[model samples]
Target chain A: MIRLEQVSVFFGPTIALDGLDTTIEPGITGLFGPNGSGKSTLLRVVAGLLAPNAGRVTFEGSPVATSDEGFVRRVGYAGHSAGLYSRLTVRENLELFAVLHGRVRPDLEPLLEQIGLAEHSATRAGVLSAGLKQRAAVARALVHSPDVLLLDEPYANLDDEAAALVSCAIQEWWTPQRIALVATHGAKKLKAFAHGGLILKRGRTVVQGSYRERPEAETFS
Target chain B: MSGVGFVAKTAALTRKDLRVEARSRDTLPPMLAFAFTVALVLAFTLPDATRASAKVVAGFLWITVLFAGLIGFARTFEVEREEGALDALLLVPLDRSGIFFSKAAANLVFLALVEVFLVPVFGLFFSLDLSSWLMLALVVVLVDIGFVAVGTLFASLASQTRSRELILPILALPVLVPAFIAGVELSADLFAGAGLDDIAARGWFGILLFFDAVFLVVGALGFEFAID
Candidate 1:
């Protein structure tokens, strides 16, 4: 489980995350918010990328710090930007991450196949369409088989086929033993998949419930 | 997931950099081209008398290497920045020191490759003896290590800022003054036929070593904060 206790983040004078508190259980949780509503900031904080000023983010019972090797290894984060080496081939990119994550003789063929990049495994990421690049990013994030996966706008620029590929990948990977939090503006797409979700306004959680019980479910259309 | 050992991580990162450079040719060719161009321009500017002086030749050669290295450092983190790959790098469980050292090692290799052509061309242009050429190689290796040790740290820091092009030199050049002075002084002594036994040459070499040790430590310890 992941828990944020009175978490607050500041970017200069701007309050990116207010004194927000929430608990995220295992399984996929759709993170919905308008632009500038702290969705990315919240995900970054959970991923141990950004440190909150006034609160604590804990995985299980331990605090999440970038310096903590054990904690970091359990987390996988894919930001809005693909976070891939444009110059690297898809296979090389996955292999690099796998090696870094300490997989001796890492088997990347399955991941490439699952992400629908096996055909373009040798192609450089820079030349791929935006949707393909996003798929590569997702594959890289899962190379380690992390326990906590945080994806920020994973389906943003993907085509219908590409989005379906992502949704399938997420469903296959996000088991009960793992926690996956996906942030997206399109709640309708997530309504069919997410078990629960949190809606952020400004820097605070305005609503928290199952998708069907959400007050803004009508607006999801 | 179990994390890779420090040595393994560092080697993997170094190999990744070399592979990327080999395919993309994003860093080395431009660096070599710029260094060669600088050598040509400087060669033309020198008069016959000045060209014959080993001191003048050594000074100009080090200057050319320094500027060429600056160009290389400017692009060190550029590819990562473009795709937000640095965030992924940070996500790796390896120690931040490993990241710093690997990057410095890669930069050192790139600088040394440029020197493979650069030193020979410099020797040919100046008509330097073979013995001086030997000492010049040693100087280049030491000087390049010192340059990349500090350059990698500043490049990583400057890359986080919006004006990375303007910020890298600003952050790096000031800290590199001592190394620059030592490189020029040592190169001049080597070209003047001073062996390692010469006190002047040995003293400048010591200064260069000190600079390398200091900056390497600083870069290893400070890299986490710089990227954070």
Candidate 2:
């Protein structure tokens, strides 16, 4: 389990995350919010990309900081930007990430096929289509088999087929021992697949429960 | 990530950068173009290349390299900034300082390649004596360490700001004065056909060695926080 306690992040006068407190259990949790709602900030804090200004985020039982090697190893993230080296081919990018994760040159052919990038493996990430780049990023995140997955808007540009491929990949990757926090505005498939949801407004949690109890994006505001 | 040792990580990152550069041909080509243009203009404009003062030749040669290095330094970090790829690297569990060192190492290699073309152009164009050109090469190698050390750090820091192209030179120049002075002073004597013993007597060698060491230490320690 990952627990956030009084976590606050301030960007000068703007409050990005306002003293958020929550506990995320072992399963996929949908993180929902409208524009400027701080969904990304909360995920960044949990993923140890940005340290909270005022509070502590603990994974399992230990505090998480950007410097914490264990927390970093445990988390895999696909940000809003498709974070692949533009000059590297999709295969090379995945291989590089594998090496960075301390694995030997991996046979990522299976993963490439899973993400529907097998045909585009030799293509440089810079010139890949938007949907393919997003898929490549998702594959890069999963290459290390991280115990905690923090995916931000994974379905933003993907078409129906690509979205289903990614959804299947994520669902298959999640096990009882792992926890995944997926931050998106609203997707029916993601809503159905997620075990629970946390909706935020201006960085503070506005609601937390099963989908039926949670308000839709339009009604929540 | 824990078991990935520092040496392996650094080597991997450096190799990846070089491989990408080799295929993309992005950073080096433009850098080479810029450096050679400086050499071309100097070669033609001077009344007589060989008759030019050692100070003028030396100053221009090093100045050409210094300005061209700015291009290479910025380009080296451009790979990391694309599509927020830098955040992905940071998310890895390795010590963040390794990122700084790898980047500096790669920038040093890029600058060295530029000089490979640049030094020869200066020597041929100016008709300088090559008997002691090796001594001049030593000065360049020594001073470039300090140049790249601070250049890589400041490049990363300035990358965060809005006006990075304008900000890089401004942030990096003040700290680089000592290396610039050392490179020019040592190279002038070498260009004038002075041997190592004679060049060493001038004491710019000491300044350069000390400056390189200090900048290297500062870069390694401050790099992680600089990006933060």
Candidate 3:
């Protein structure tokens, strides 16, 4: 379980996450918000990439800081920008992550196949198309089989087929032991997979419940 | 996921860097070309008498290496920044110091390769005997460590700025003055037939080592904050 208590984040004068409080259990939790709605900030904080100004974030009860190597090992984050080495081949990129995570014999072939990149595994990531690169990023994120996964706008630049691939991969990877937080703009797509979700407006949580109880269109507009 | 041991993580990171450089051929060739071009320009421009002096030649060679190395340093984190790879690396559970050491090692290798071409060309142009080549090689190795130690830290810091190309040299060169001076002085002593036993030569070597140690420790300690 992950908990954010009285969490507040600021960027200059802008409030990125405003006194936000929430708890997420083990499951797929879709983060629904429009632009600048703090979805990315929330994921970043949970991933230990950013620290909150006024509160604390805990993973299974321990505070998560960027410097906590032990805490970070169990968590995986893929941001809006696909964090990949452009000069490295898809296989090499995944292999590096696996090594870092201390996997002695990483099952790379399966991951490559799962992400629909087995054919392009040898290709340099710099030359891969946007959709394929996104898939590669997803594959890299899951290479270590982290207990906590945070993905921000994973399907932003993907084509329909690529998006489907990523969506299915996430579904296939999700389990009771792993907590996945997917921040996305696609409501209908997320509705199909997410058990529950939170809706944010202007850095505040406006709604929190099962996807079926999402606020009407007037509340969002 | 338990993280790998420190040595294993550092080796993996270094290998990744070398493999990327080996395939892309992006960093080393440009560094060598820049160094060689500067040497050629210096060869034609220097006065005939001044060009023959070992001190003058050593000074020019060190300058060429320093400026050429700036190119490598600038690109150190630029590659990571280009594709958001730095964030990926940071997300790993290994100590951030491992990232710093691995990058410094890789930069040292690139700089050393450039020196392989540089030393021979420098000797040929200056009409100097290669008798002191061993000592000179040691000087190059020590100096490269100092350079990369400080350079990698500043490179990571500069990568966060919008004007990274401008910010790297500005931030690195000022902090590197002591190392640069030590490198030039030590190289000059080596070229002038001073043995390692010579008091002045030993002093400069000590300075080089000291600078390397200090910058490496600082870089390792401060790297997490700089990137975070």
Query: Which lDDT tens digits does candidate 3 get at residues A83-169?
Result: 898888898899898998888667799888877999999999999998888888888889888888898888877777778888888
What are the per-residue Cα lDDT tens digits for candidate 2 across B11-106?
Answer: 889999999899889889989999999999989999998899988998998889998999878776778778888778887877878888899889
C-alpha lDDT of residue B158 in model 3: 88
Better of 1 and 2 by DockQ: 1
In order, how many clashes per candidate? 0, 0, 0
What does the interface RMSD come to for each candidate?
A: 1.7, 2.0, 1.8
Worst 10-residue lDDT window, candidate 3 chain A:
A212-221
Q: Which residue window of length 10 is worst by lDDT in model 1 chain B?
A: B193-202
C-alpha displacement of A106 in model 1, angstroms? 1.4
- Candidate 1's C-alpha runs over 4 A off are A211-221, B1-3, B49-51, B199-202
Model 3 lDDT per residue over B141-164, tens place:
888898999899999898888887
Error of 1 at B163 (Å): 2.2
Report per-prediction Cα RMSD to one decimal.
2.3, 2.5, 2.4
Across A1-221, the per-residue lDDT of candidate 2 in tens digits comes to 99999999999999999999899988888888888889999888888889899999999989876667667777899998888999899999998888888887688988998889999999999999999999999999999999999999898888889999999999989998899898876457687678778888999999887555454532432
lDDT of 3 at A208: 77
* Model 2: per-residue Cα lDDT at residue B11: 83
lDDT top scorer: 2
